[model samples]
Target: MRQTRLRPPRLKAGDGVTVVSPSWRGGEVFPQRAARGAADLTARTGLRVSISSVKPGLCPESRAGRAEEFNRAVQDPATRAILWMIGGLTASELLPLIDYEAFGARPKVLCGYSDATVLHHALYARTGATTFYGPALLSQFAENGGTPELTMDSFAELTMRGWTGRFPTASEVIEEFVDWADDSRPRRAVPALPRKALRPGLAQGPLLAGCVPSALQLLGTPWLPDYRGHVLAFEFTDDNGYGPGQAARDLWQLRHAGLLDGVEGLVLGRPRGWSDAQREQLERIVLDVCHGTAFPIVTEFEFGHTDPVLTLPTGVPVELDNTTLTLLEPSVR
Candidate 1:
């Protein structure tokens, strides 16, 4: 019972974008980062940016207010795309008030991740609107002076124009995370190990994933987009009172629900904010799950909450092999 895929229109230069806060308004908390992000989106990406929620205050005040702003942006003809500000644990609370019909009637590029993952799943399942698992306003694009080249490049490809190519190689990863304080603390760098093929083989299907912990919250909910026949990807981010055991359990939940019955491949994003012991334990859990299948598994991708991450188009077709993943179709156009 898969819905026909919905792809948003590719953006062009000067197209107006509305930065909506479907969750916490990170911009409100960090005004400097917020201003820098808005200005950078125009200066760096060449897109005309406007505001929906980045105001003179933190905390959106009410769920109804956030939903109203989001729906208004969707219905606005001038706004071609809507970018999320930042993800929070309470995104699901806004789901009830979202105008899904309006979203279905006019699909536009909706980009975000982490807590924004909830909105992506709900929109795709309820209205079949394709969404981007990419950067947000105050978090990714507004990083200090600017974001990394890798982040900017991939984001342009996925959001501004449709891309049909391999994921651009990430030379290194920023593993050292500094708590976001005033005046900006930067993400520290580490050498990126070459991606390893886990249980190598080949598989082709629509791509669907998010930070597994965020994704797990949608389990058993109608808003959880169907994962069947999709190349499933998962990663660890914003540890919500969980660890490797919880990660493994979430994977088992999918298997238990028979959601993975039609899946043929898997990808694991690089472990950010995790130790060697934790990563090892997590890998053991993954290997145990894949013991019987050569399902074209690959790990250590630069996505999730890690810095210099790739902007992935959810619900798009992709081909996976031992060494690489290639998009079979354009994500935006």
Candidate 2:
């Protein structure tokens, strides 16, 4: 049964936001970069920002600590939103510790991507809270020079103010990473390739967007959402262990689980750190797995680990026809 989707109140200037690390402690590992991100976030949105009280550790106890920070942020009336410090592998570890009841009672804007996809699906399943699948602190705002205008503008339009209509794509994307140790160096970007139409058709349905591997990890768990009648959007991350092989297996896993049975459309983000050949292989793998599916399939739409991404609201209605994507409803009140 699908829960009643809740659209959190839109943010305004001076809205309070709490940054939490439910996964990797990017803030703890790179304090200078974190500081830069925090400053940039405030400057960009005029939202007063504060960091949650959590430390870096991979111990069992650390997960509990991270969950507590997330809970407090959700429960606090002063916090209009919760921002992720960064995405990592351990977000699933905090799933058991999250206070879904508190989150349901006090639905606040939640923004993140990559590993945070698990949390998004969990929230959508348990609370029906619409969360923004967008940039993380260190990853976007803390970019060496500054946050990309396209990324910040989308974040503001979708999460802070209400927005509806066609989504914009970034003409250039930051694919090259500048080491955190060299915080002064700006990231180099390459021109974005045109989006491809893997399967041609048209459809509009509620958007279900997330990281590929993180979302697959939720399969068979209560956190995995009901994808029937959804326009599923996913992106491959730059995680060292993931590649075209894993991508095939993951999509097949979804197909086997029947999660793709009623999907209305499919949108894929350009994979981070992927060569042209690898991307072509990925497209072939997708078509093979979703073979005979009548829905439209588009690839290389911007989102996920890449810089200058759109802030997509999970659970909102979206139209996808070939390479074009449009938001059909407001993501926030």
- Per residue, candidate 1 scores C-alpha lDDT tens digits across 168-208 of 66878776655666545666677887788867888888888
lDDT of 2 by residue, 12-69 (tens): 9899999988988878779989999899989888999888775356342377778878
TM-score for each predicted model, relative to the true structure: 0.92, 0.96
Deviation from native of the Cα of residue 296 in model 1, angstroms: 2.1
Candidate 1 has its poorest 10 consecutive residues by lDDT at: 53-62
Q: Total clashes, candidate 2?
A: 0
Give candidate 1's whole-model lDDT. Answer: 0.80
Model 2 TM? 0.96
Report residue 53 deviation for candidate 2 (angstroms).
Answer: 1.6
Residue 250 of model 1: what lDDT? 80
